[model samples]
Target: MNLDDLAEKAEEYRARDAGITHEVRVCVAAACQSGGSLPVLEALKAECDSGGTCKVKGVGCMGLCSAGPMVAIAPKGGAIPDSILYREVKPEDAADVLASVGGAPVERLHTPTDQPFFARQQRIVRENSGLIDPESFTGYVAAGGYAGLIKALSEMTPGDVLREMTTSGLRGRGGGGYPTGLKWSTVAKMPADQKYVICNGDEGDPGAFMDRAVLESDPHRVLEGMCIAAYAIGATKGYVYVRAEYPLAVQRMELAIRKAKRSGFLGSKIAETQFSFEVEIRLGAGAFVCGEETALMASIEGLRGQPRPRPPYPAEAGLWGYPTLINNVETFANIAPIITHGGEWFAGIGTAKSKGTKVFALAGSIKNIGLIEVPMGMSLREIIEEIGGGCPGGKAFKAVQTGGPSGGCIPAAHLDIAVDYDSLKTLGTMMGSGGMIVMDETCDMVDVARYFMEFCMSESCGKCIPCRTGTWQMHELLDRITKSKGTHKDLALLEELCDVVQATSLCGLGQSAPNPVLSTLRYFREEYEAKLTAE
Candidate 1:
């Protein structure tokens, strides 16, 4: 088949296949694999081996990695009425799942589609997540993947694209919460011959994998988003700077890019439009500092990946000294939707301030630790108790670590606090790249602060003394506190040092490094005082 014919044939096959075959997609992703998905896969295969024409495919990942060994069954028609999403599947549950092939509906494995985790989520960025095979371009296309790019190129003007984003209330998911439209407008208006769009996949936060999951589960979604972004911002070249640690995510993204290029979805005049866009992959050397925009830009340019001070922001002077629109993976993933469906539709979903759903890598002591996307204005108590299924060991909820080492810890008393940008900041935390780690009573608050302090100290870029030296000093003090060797004077010293670090820090690394310490002290002052009293 020629290129056009092959494309047509692929589309026809996908549609036809969707009708005749029953797709039993099992999660063989990293998180699910660790939770015994292989055995579940074997069991499903064994059932399929004994029987009829059931297509049991091993897909990349479901965002709900914690509720692993997940299973989804797509019936022989045009998508089942909410495809059966089975969590915590075991090998023994295989027969019941397979036996339900004829639409009996497996009662035990069926997860309600109307729950807060699924219901509250407006899956624009993560549309293909947990649904399509991350490696397959055909699968993505089948799920209305490139349609947004098609819509953008065919109908929306560059100005229109920028305007829609501004109206959509889409903010940067890359921690800063900058208006995406304004950022794009800057790059679009910049007086530069060569402009670049960058996808920041260098997700360095300790328990944060929302970006990694999107890259692994829906790489093409990100690619489609980037392509649309390049068109929107008048950029010819783009790059995705992902960290080296996410081997699977990198591999999947690389494969997706190749397929997209081969299918004429990425190259010159994509889908027969005047816009031409191409993207390259730059692998970061696993430097945590690279998560910073300047640092990420520097690393992409083959430098040491350190952050320089900002008057020449990336939009003005970026990679190779050209205008660049750098957005996080999740940020880019939201582009297509803002294009396809009007921005108003998206804006209506979440809170007035924080529009659209936020995806999080929910982990730690929670019973249902996994990746979840919830709308803004949801209470922390609701998330922990209702959506997350509460603490695993039935222990008392202690605190939650939002935003990463650079984030703060929320005590149990503040569980009712609304989880929005302003609210989190008011509580001495920021709605950082959405990593919510639940801690139970077993966790030592002093140790938690010390752990995050150490992470910040180790990951500090050392470009600024406040982050480099201050984080170390704070960590040392925290170490003393946790080890029962701290005095009242040391506690005072830790508080004072956190303030100095916050005041004098450069970039977000130094600035937010004291957040965990500050927030912990605010809520858990008694805990710190208790340690000293015990000593």
Candidate 2:
């Protein structure tokens, strides 16, 4: 389709929802759904039916999931729409919520949209989330989707597309912040006739839900980004490796693939050009190691998921030994915006090194637990205090753990630290797929270390001695220390083992397994010492 035709399609979709003035939006994403959003949706829909003037729309996450089931009211058509949230809503409150559709909002149920939880966000990847229905292909198209792919295919050369990405300073959001453009260029330049693009959605971190939320909320955005990557790398086929546990995400992505293929946006002769691309879905069997690219490729190829040493990386020789480019769901989700609004625009929004935004799954003891996106330079204090609303029960904040099992903890002392890649690294942490779990004063630092070590131990694929045996030993020592076992020598042995495991590990899973233990030891050594018996 041509530019005018695409624009017309967008307009056609836009008109369908825009004409409805009064609307009730319910958070139908996984979190809210678990918190009883479906019955609430039915109630709201019934109320809307009775009123006839108002409409009930089931949308994705609006964040603030701790207070779900959440409901919002808004006027549909406007240059800028105004929305009011009702948190902890139930089916019984549907009538009262409906009563406020075109009128005054219920005071008791109202949550100000202007709160820092929502206001502080810069939603590049999640822009369409909660605003459009995820299952509705037309709703996505109406929201200015697929325009980026069209622009890339019809107007720009593949080289031009790579240059745009290079200018954007976009880095992989998947634990390692590798430069995105550099990887794409490597794949594009490789001498492989069968280049492939893969979007990694197999997020298995204990507290991380950023990728799952993005996939469930906006599958099209990820697809568009994947398509853009395919075009840039001269790949005619792609795969999205998502976890089987995320049945909703898998279902939505499958539907999105089918819809996009039917619409001529994906698969064979796109926009009637020489380019033809197809995308398949590969479901991971809940193995954390498969989140790594090599292991993920192995699982996709029907092999046991285990990481091999990397020198010939996935870009050099990947799935089926062809040149492949792999980026996570969040990384791909950022592509459409980068293409639509030039790379310079994205580069301008974030810090000098980390461009655009990072999507984090705010979890643990925080009061406003949900998915959030903030600009790279935003401080941890802002995220924890302002957006997360601190710990519940008015408890004193302890530390926030970023990067899951492979990440470290930042004590309250470093709350003012900038949350970008470099700054987090300085704090002995890495932003591993964006999981920020808050801890309160009541939390035990030793236990925390033991907990994460246990997770890493269990999730270890046992492919290497450093990760398998080392993690097991660390967990035992941490468990012993937490249980007030005898000897300061245990502490010495744990520290030495940490160094050995980190230095000798075969893959990222092994290399970074000791981060949580080491970080807690660095800041909360007193806790470990207290747990030890007198020598």
Candidate 3:
């Protein structure tokens, strides 16, 4: 399909939708589905079919996961935020919901859109998440889905795309915060005839579902972003490596690929241009290490998922010894927007070094638990108190863990710090895929350190002694301290092990495995000291 054909498709879909007076959207994403959204969806559909100007459809996550099964009703061509939202909806509420679509909203079921949980988010990656039917290709097209790819193909050259990316200052969202434009340029400059682009969807971090939500909610958006990356970097083939645990995400992404291929967006001569790229889905065995780029490529090659030391990184040598460009689900999801709105427009948001927005999954003791995206320079206090609604039951906020098993926990003393790549590093943490688990006053810091250490020890690939044995040793010492069976020597020993593991580890998993222990000790050392037995 050419530019004109794409526009015609979008117009046709919009024209068909214009006839409807009201639309009812049900959150059918995994979170809401588990909360019984499917039955609600079917019930709403039955009511809409019985007779009304109302149409019912299934959408992706609405962000307030605790409030599901959520429903939204909107006027034709209206935005989702302005829609009448209903929380914890039941199947029997369908008739009342449909009846009150353009009339008075069901007061008992109504959820205010003006709440901080919904209003505070700056959605770039999740802009279309709760708005469209994820499985509908025409629905995505009508929402201006692939316009960025078509624009890149018909108007801009490869260098121009690269330049736009550079101007946008987008960083890799899969942690490490590497510049996206630099990585793409490196892959594009490679002298190989065969190049590959891989999207890392193995989101194994605890309390993190940002990637899964993006993949399931706006599968076409990811595909369109991948297509844009392929065109810019001259990649003929690509693979999305998602863990088997995310069945819904994999299913939606697979369906999106098929639809795009049928519409001439994935096969030979995409958009009727010289750019031709094909994408496939590769299921991971739920190995946490495979979230690392090298290990992800190894899994794609049908080998044991493990990380090798990097110098010849994925951008240099990857996937069958050819140049490969690897980016996480969120990084690619930002591509279309950057291309559509120039890179400078994106650079205008966020901080000086870290531009664009970051999507975070809020969990633990927070009252408003769900997915959210905010600008880079947003303070941790703002995220926790304002957006997350602080801790539940008025318990004082104690600390929050960032970056999952490989990250450090920030105590209440540093809550006002800006959450950028550099600021997090200064606090002895890195943004490892944007998972934030808040803690309250009752939590024991020593146990929190042990818990994450246990997770790392279990997930260790055992390829390196530092990660394999070091994590185990750290866990044991923390366990002893928590039980009040360890002396001062044990605390000193734990500190030394953290140093060794951080300095001598083979991969990121081993290296950052000491973060929880170190960060907790740095801020809450009194907890460990109080637990220690007399020498």
Candidate 4:
């Protein structure tokens, strides 16, 4: 299966669908499934089966999660954005939806696609997310899924792939902001006999589901990206470390691995070339610390999931003393597009430093609570107000939290800041896996800081004294402040603890645990001062 063979296969699949005049796509991703999408899907399938030229298929998430179960009706080979979308659909509404397929849309259920939620997004990572059946190998191939891996295997050498990656200027999407090309080049240059590539899918952030959605919606895309990374870094074996809490993502990924193996995409001599790669899924046991690369590698090695100190990073020594290349789900999802288009094509999209779009789980008080992929350097105001539809109800926007528990909250005053790596860091926040949680004016800044501190304290692996003890002390101080039992001395101690924990922690988890507290103090210091009791 070379380039020509892959193209022929894709064309054959497209040809089979040419006979169908109308296609009804139903969202069957986990969120919609929980909203009774399966029954709706079955109802639509039954209605379409008895009717003319209409084909019904179950696809992944359509991004407007609040209005699911969503159904899209379109002509054959039409894009999802051009489809007639129906929201909050039920089994009883299936007939009406099918009847309106070629006619006027059902006005009661129709959702216009011209809204900012749909228009503002740059959907490179999620291009095929809601369009194809996630479990179908042919569906993925038709959507140009493995073209990057095939291209790398056929035309480019290991060094050539590294050069293209470097030219793309893509940084790691796993919140570290490390250069992806630099990491790959380091592993490629190493003279190790055995190397490993690990996709860190252990997204345990409180409001983060970006990685989960990508894996659930397009498992094949991630696999293809891993294949390209392995080929470039000269690794024949890879592992995807996903948290066990995301059962749907794990199930889809497992099925994708089996299908790819059967289709000659995995196992020995992939695409009939000298480069071969094999991948396995490693399930994390709901540990937040495993999101760190060294802790993740430790968990994959059957040890207790805890972060180790870093002078010898994963690229230098990892996975039982073998060099390993670790990237998050969203990072790998970007690989196919960078390879399909030239590296410069991607570099032209985002800011000077952050060179691509970012996928975020827009949660909390926002009106549009779903997944979004926006270009880097887009303003926070645009994301929260335009794409997210602003805060629900009549409440004023107070702050928006980026990067999960590891991130800081941006006050409303700084909403105009560009959302790139350097810009966010200047505001005392890091892009920790693209979790943007909005807060309304009613939220108490002191309580918000306390909440994140509690999460960090509970999630700490207790391996190092700084993270375990420091997070616990900070949570205690925050709780006292929130309850009006704290004095000005406690406030001073809390600020001092933030500095100590940030500088002394062993891994990223502890080091960045004080972000929410520090950022709140920076912008909302009056909130804490107001809560402090007289000594």
Candidate 5:
């Protein structure tokens, strides 16, 4: 299809939608689905069909994942403002929920939009989240989707797309803070006939759901970004490496890719241009290391998933020895917006070093346990206290874990620190895929470190000695310490192991595995020291 066809489709969908009196959006994302959103959606659909006043549509994550299954209702021609949200909704409550549409409010079920949990989030990556039916091509087009891809395909050349990306100042959102434009430029510059763009969606972090939310909420957004990236880097093929665990995300993305190809946004000759791109989903068998760029490409190639050294990085020779462009879900999600709104507009959002908003999956010990997209420089205190609504009980906040097992923990004293890349690293933490797990005073720091060490130890692919053995040894030491049977030498040995692993590990996984141990040592040495024997 052509540009006018896309616009015409959008307008047609909008026109059809405007005629409906009430539209009900049921959160059918993994979180809400587990909370019985499917049954609730069925109930709403049945009720709406019976009445015809309200039409039910299953949408993506509504962000307040903690209080689900959630549903939002709005009168036609009006968006979220005219909508009313209901939290902790049940299948039986669907009838009552429908009654509240254009009528009186349900006091117990109503979730206000003005709350800091909703108000504070600047949702660029998640702009379509909770608002659109993710599976609907017409719905996405109606919401100004594919315009970026159309713009890239029709108006600008591939070089122009790269220039716009370079101007945006966007960085890799998948742990490493590499420049997005620089990576694309490297792949573009690489002299290869076959380059590939891979979207790393194997989000295996213990508490991180950021990538999954993006994939579930806005699959087309990621697809569009992939299309733009493919066009920019001269790559004709792409793969989305998602974990087998995230069935819903995989399902949605698979559907979206099929729809995208059929709509001509992806696959052969898009917008009547000679440039062609094809995307496929490669399911990762729950390996955390596959989230790494090299490992992910290896997985896509039907090999054992493990990371290799990165000088001849993915840019030069990757994915069957041709140049490859790798980025995660959130990174891709940012591309469409950066293209639509000029690069300078995006550059103006966050701190000087870290540009654009970061989507975080706030989990553990927080009141508002959900997905949120906040400006990069937002303070840890603001996220934990204000947006996340702080620790649930009267207990004082203890620490917040910024990254996953590969990241360190920041104590309560450093809560004022901005949640940017460099700032977090200074405090002994890196933004590891935006999995921010808040901890309260009740959490034992020693046990917390042990818990994460256990995760790294388990998730290690055992391909390298440092990651495999070091993580195991560290877990052993932490296990001894947390069990209250450790001596001073154990702590020294653990510190030594951290240094060895950080210095010598073959991949980012092994290298950063010691983060939890190191950061805890830096911030809460008292906790570790208290557990030690007097000898």
Candidate 6:
């Protein structure tokens, strides 16, 4: 029942079950709930209940929210050709769904292998996502998981680990896109008696669930990633700062941490290595500002989470005034792969500037709406039309608002722009936590800017003058424009405020808060101009 024995048992169980039968897994996540996954689960359950040849399992979100009520059928064992994925399942079609397990083809429900959505996806962070029960730790280890952590601890040294990460060109996925190895190296070089590694899981961006999916589906991956990071950074303590809204993710992570501790994967020397590390969870009370590093560290220390003026950055002085390395959940999830597979392999996948794959919670007007990961250079058009299955209801793709409220909207003219940190920044946008929301013609640009400005205004920490007051003023102007009560002077004033906030803001939340407005103005200034004249 110890960690070591459990890991062994997990491997044994996987081998033993390698030839059992077959199973069809139905997703019962929130997205699927909206898509009526309960009915699909019930149908699968009924089919399995009635002496069906296959077993049925219920799982968490697969990141494919558009095609909900999704199911993945494994051929009992690890049979050939991989398991088939079915989307948009209905209750009445359960019998037909079950029939597709062996030979029959439920043409309507099937997601073709050649489809763009699955064709290019390389699932690493999402490896165990749709297939395994999130609550089951054993299910995770059985799926070639934890082997990475074991490899890192039992084989590689801290310096070696950092080298692999740097060479791999893995950047932070929490919108910053800083090189992962460089961040760790800075923390490692800092002279400190004690150091901390923190996982920034307070994902507040709208229409983004990359972190939540990892926590909900493969909690161990994040944990293992953290452990590897701890080893690399020579840290003994760590915290996973998740949002309170994600009760399910928090529950699963808590369970996972406990399981890891009991199995000796956490707490003390793991896998008989000389190093020791432990992880704890700090739940945020839904404060969007806490996603910032300094604020996150403040919250962990039981203080009111607010951003302070930097210079004593978290890298040098953070989390109880010691050196700390803070990285987002998705960024941490990539650690194991880099450690196990080597950095060159990872660096080879994405674009020249931004290395490694980016997992996007593909929602909005796209067709095959769900969770997807593609290389860095993939075009927005490919993502929207090809992978996202194009806009639903025959609507023309108007624009995509990447980076949530903090990111700019790239209109149809720039749909071909490659997605990466530098590339997006060049287009007056930054890759902000991989939130790609599609917009159709019905979505007014002015209104969209107003909506996101409202969000930024509400989420603003009020600690800085530029963000606290600037964003509020911008919101007021936008509100007037949306209601058709604005004039030409307002537009000029808006530009002035954007300059002030972008230049004087303390942190990223304020610095990037003007992106939505700026990008909208760049692409759709006419919308604001038209609003200047009232009837």
What lDDT is reached at residue 3 by model 6?
Answer: 42
> Using lDDT as the measure, what is the rank order of every candidate, best first?
3, 4, 2, 5, 6, 1
Error of 2 at 117 (Å): 0.6
Against the hidden true structure, what lDDT does model 5 obtain?
Answer: 0.89
Task: Give me the runs in candidate 2 sitting further than 4 Å from their true place.
Answer: 50-53, 77-81
Model 6 stretches with alpha carbons more than 4 Å out:
1-10, 33-53, 76-81, 90-96
Q: Whose TM-score is higher: candidate 3's or candidate 6's?
A: 3
Candidate 3 on 397-488: residue-level lDDT in tens?
99999999889999999999998998999999888899999999999999999999999999999999999999999999999999999899
Off by over 4 Å in 3: 1-4
lDDT of 3 at 68: 91
TM-score of 5: 0.97
**lDDT on C-alpha atoms for all candidate structures:** 0.83, 0.89, 0.92, 0.92, 0.89, 0.84
Flag regions of model 1 displaced more than 4 Å. Answer: 1-13, 18-21, 36-53, 76-81, 87-96, 103-120, 533-535
- The whole-model C-alpha lDDT of candidate 3 against the native structure comes to 0.92
TM-scores of the candidates are 0.93, 0.97, 0.98, 0.99, 0.97, 0.93
Taking the tens digit of each residue's C-alpha lDDT, what string does model 4 give over 1-535?
A: 6678889999999887776898899998989999999999999888776546888998988898888999999887677678899999999999999999789999999998879888889899999888899989999999887999988888888888899999999999989899999999999988899999999999998888888889999999999999999999999899999999999999999999999999888999998888789999999998999999999999999999988888698898999999999998999999989988979999999999999999888999999889988999999999999999999997999999998888999999999998988999999998888999899999998999999999999999999998999999999999999999999999999999999999999999999999999999999999999999999
lDDT of 4: 0.92
> Can you give the lDDT of residue 111 in candidate 3?
90
lDDT tens digits, residue span 1-535, model 5: 5568778878988887565787789998999999899999988887776546667899889788999998988775344545788998988887788878788879899988778888888989988888889888888999989988887787788898898889889999998999999999989998888999999898988899989888998899999999999999999999998999999899999999988888777888877889899999999897888888888888888988888887889899899999999998899999988887878999999999899999999999999999999999999989989989988877798899988988989988898988899999999999989998988888998899999898899889998998899999999999999988999999999999999999999998998999998999999999999999877
Over 4 Å off, model 4: none
> Per-candidate RMSD vs. true structure?
3.0, 1.5, 1.1, 1.0, 1.4, 2.7
Candidate 5: where is the Cα deviation over 4 Å?
1-5, 49-53, 77-82
- Which ten contiguous residues of candidate 4 have the minimum total lDDT? 45-54
TM-score of the candidate numbered 1?
Answer: 0.93
